[model samples]
Target: MGIFIRILGAFVLLSATYNPTRWNFTRWAEANWGTQMPLTLLFGLLLGVGYLIYIGATLRSIGAFGIVLVAAIVGALVWVLIDYQILTLQNPSVNLWLGIIAL
Candidate 1:
């Protein structure tokens, strides 16, 4: 169940990336069908909330140190992938700057 929630959350996060409309209700509704907008928002929110809850539960089962280790590993993997251009460096310097700020 926890694994399922994490996968669902990842999917939602990916979808949200494509639909910048999520942050703007009027633009979203105008661009997409009203029914679709509501459904998308509901699913995205549910996935996001479920993912965080499940990750917290799973991390608790592991331990605090495990969470830190996992985060570091994932961060390193993202950096490597981006550096290698295996993952499109969308905004290039801007993205690197943003990443620095995020840390």
Candidate 2:
């Protein structure tokens, strides 16, 4: 229950500043001289790694009964810190709110 709230809040907060251009990271390939194919593959690989990190973090939070709320809290904080550079009042407002709720 609490984990759901934290995730929802994080998504709502992070999506506000999210830029799709970040996803189009393969533009670097065009400048590299015929490396477009490999660049696209690399982009895909990076996205996969991000997803794997997310999954691993979530899985680690699970305990004998269910998801540990504090684990989710820590994971969310680490995620926002690493992924979006969001740690202060400038970003992740909803995450801050979620943290309050979790507490």
Candidate 3:
């Protein structure tokens, strides 16, 4: 159950970070604030901090190695799903890979 929650959390985090139709900060900034490097940096920092917090909490509950193992499983699952067209992505980029690894 704990591991399941972790997996679900990882999926949610990845979606929030990478899904353009969802909570994609980069897309939002580009549309509203224009394509500026400073805004990109700011959004990146915010996302990075959020990722750290989420990872820290997961690590606290699962330990370092366990977290890594979980991340690997989640990443592989995501990659396979995307590759097989189980998950539809309009423009999958490095962020998708990073999000999977971060999960």
Which tens-of-lDDT digit does each residue in 5-61 have in candidate 2?
Answer: 767654543333232334234334445536567766675576667656655666776
Model 1: per-residue lDDT, tens digit, 2-51?
77776666555444434333454334545676659777677557666865
Candidate with best TM-score = 3
Residue lDDT tens for model 3, 1-103: 9878867777766675666364576566666675577867787787788788877887788899997787789878878977997767665665565555554
Best by lDDT: 3
Query: What local distance difference test score does each model get?
Result: 0.61, 0.55, 0.71
Using TM-score, rank the candidates from best to worst: 3, 1, 2
Give the poorly placed runs of model 1, Cα more than 4 Å off.
Answer: 9-52, 91-103
Provide the lowest-lDDT 10-residue window in model 1. 17-26
TM-score, candidate number 2:
0.31
Model 2 ranges with Cα > 4 A deviation: 1-35, 63-103
Q: Clash pairs of candidate 3? A: none
Better-scoring candidate (TM-score), 1 or 2:
1
